[model samples]
Target: MRLVIAKCSVDYVGRLKAHLPLAVRLLVLKADGSVLVHSDGGSYKPLNWMSPPANMRTLSPDDVDLETGVVEQWIVQSAKTDDRLIINIYEHISDSSHDLGVDPGLIKDGVEADLQRLLAAQIDLLGDGYTLIRREYFTAIGPVDILARDAKGATVAIELKRRGDIDGVEQLTRYLELLNRDPLLAPVRGIFAAQQIKPQARVLATDRGIECKTLDYDAMRGVDDSETRLF
Candidate 1:
């Protein structure tokens, strides 16, 4: 990763126009060729960012840009789309690079992981006669949160999220696409389960023919309590 703190201005041109006036900000260049411009505040969301499958190049300031006290510029262009982000650096404050090798990715924790475990044990939450095959079912892309079979014995891929958003739907869609390719799981269907699902996510999931299930964490735990053994 490369981190640059400088006095700069940013402009984005693509599906829409956005501009960040001259100010000091942090420019993050990731190993995946993505770029993010961040201010001091505002949680983790960057002020502006270009997703991966993009390119970044540093160019010397042109005469016109030099007149404005610009010393250098970085052009970030999307490889899959026409999106572009241009950063004009007037004064460089600091720049550094770190050799942070391959990331292990995020670690699931808290209520989310616990919810998965509970749901796996109580697969009937999905529907009558639903039986869980496994949790964290492996896939070439990643692991499906839960794999199960419905009442009619149809393979079902369940993606559990704390908050169901469009991204979660996209994730389940990818898993279903891959799983359905296998003759063994050829007819796999998708169920997007979450504690709270956004309206947009529900619409997207419905449009994609994926079932949207709102999970009741407390109620599920209550059901588990009733089924617990004292032995």
Candidate 2:
């Protein structure tokens, strides 16, 4: 990944239009061909971004841009569409790249791991016709708990928690954002499931268009089943 801290302005042209006035921001160019513009605020979400497998080209500032103090500009064009993220650089504070070798993927504790296994085995619990794509689906960021397809064949990212909270929702949101970048999964939806969910978390999940589901551990463990009963 290449990380650049610079003072620059940004613009997006395609599907919709957006503009970010001159400011210092963290621009991340991931190995996966994802370009993200992030500010000090907004926590983990990027201010602007171009998803993979897009290509980037650097162009010298034109007459008007040079007059505006732009040193150079980067044109990041999406391969799937005409959407573009343009960055006009005025000053550079720092720039560096790193080789973050193979990732080991995220690890979960015993309960979380078991829950993941159970869910993957009985994915139908998610919904009728829900099919499991894979578990621990890795992306540029981290491993998604579960990746599946709904009955309609729409991609769905499921984040599991023993106790669901706002943080869990935010994590799922980031995963969804990255997954939707892939043309194969451009319209990824999210499901936040846990044994117990806080009220605030549920509200936030609903507001963010994520579906919240409550897990029943006892039922999944088959505690009520005669087959598991002891005389």
Candidate 3:
């Protein structure tokens, strides 16, 4: 059976009124479902709430299938059958150069372009049928930093950590767990890409059977890309 995910569109103008990045809070099969999300690195403590289409009914937390994990279900059902999965677990838009700099759109475009190029260069390295999907996709599993597909159509989730943190590894682990149990996308592999990696994070990934990789990028430097090889 083919699965399809509808494009998510929140009433940005009429609602929240804040530029908080729109995120896929949670994944539920029923039309009437609630999404749960919280601030990053904050003391929010993962609060779950009900927020769905007005016409749709509210679904209990148990209504969501934990089999595939919430994030995987959301992603698989949200994208078109032929579309690839590209996730960005941590996303931020700032008018400063500390991060990707101002212009969220520009940052998004640049990152997407680089990923496309990287995939193209390693076409042979990557399994067949692999394709570049979306850019800066904010999902319930944090930001789906980057999710790819293999020749067999299995997902390869990528998590990018700008700065190393124990939470980053835990978050990615959660995503992997979700994907592993998902019947629709079982056997999905995972990749952990980061600018800097914590020692503990490294050990955690190795213990969990994930391929932890290091990605190097010159910060605020105008360079075509000094180097981006994975470790």
Ranking by TM-score: 1, 2, 3
Give the range of the ten consecutive residues with the poorest summed lDDT in model 1.
222-231
**Which portions of model 1 miss their true places by more than 4 Å?**
62-66, 110-231
Q: In model 3, where do residues sit more than 4 Å from their true spots?
A: 1-130, 136-143, 151-153, 219-231
lDDT of 2: 0.91
Candidate number that wins on lDDT, 1 or 3: 1
Residue 114 deviation, candidate 1, in Å?
5.3
| Candidate 1 global CA lDDT score | 0.91
Worst 10 residues of 3 by lDDT: 1-10
Taking all chains together, the TM-score of candidate 2 against the true structure is 0.51
Q: Identify the superior model by TM-score, candidate 1 or candidate 2.
A: 1
Q: Residue 14 CA error for candidate 1 (Å)?
A: 1.3
Q: lDDT values of the candidates?
A: 0.91, 0.91, 0.49
| Candidate 3 lDDT, 1-231, residue by residue in tens | 111222222222222232333463322222343233343445655322234432222222365543332222232111213221222222222212122234445334335346434534453334457765544445555556566776777678777656656777788788878767778666877777666788888888888887776654442223544556353
The better candidate by TM-score, 1 or 3, is 1
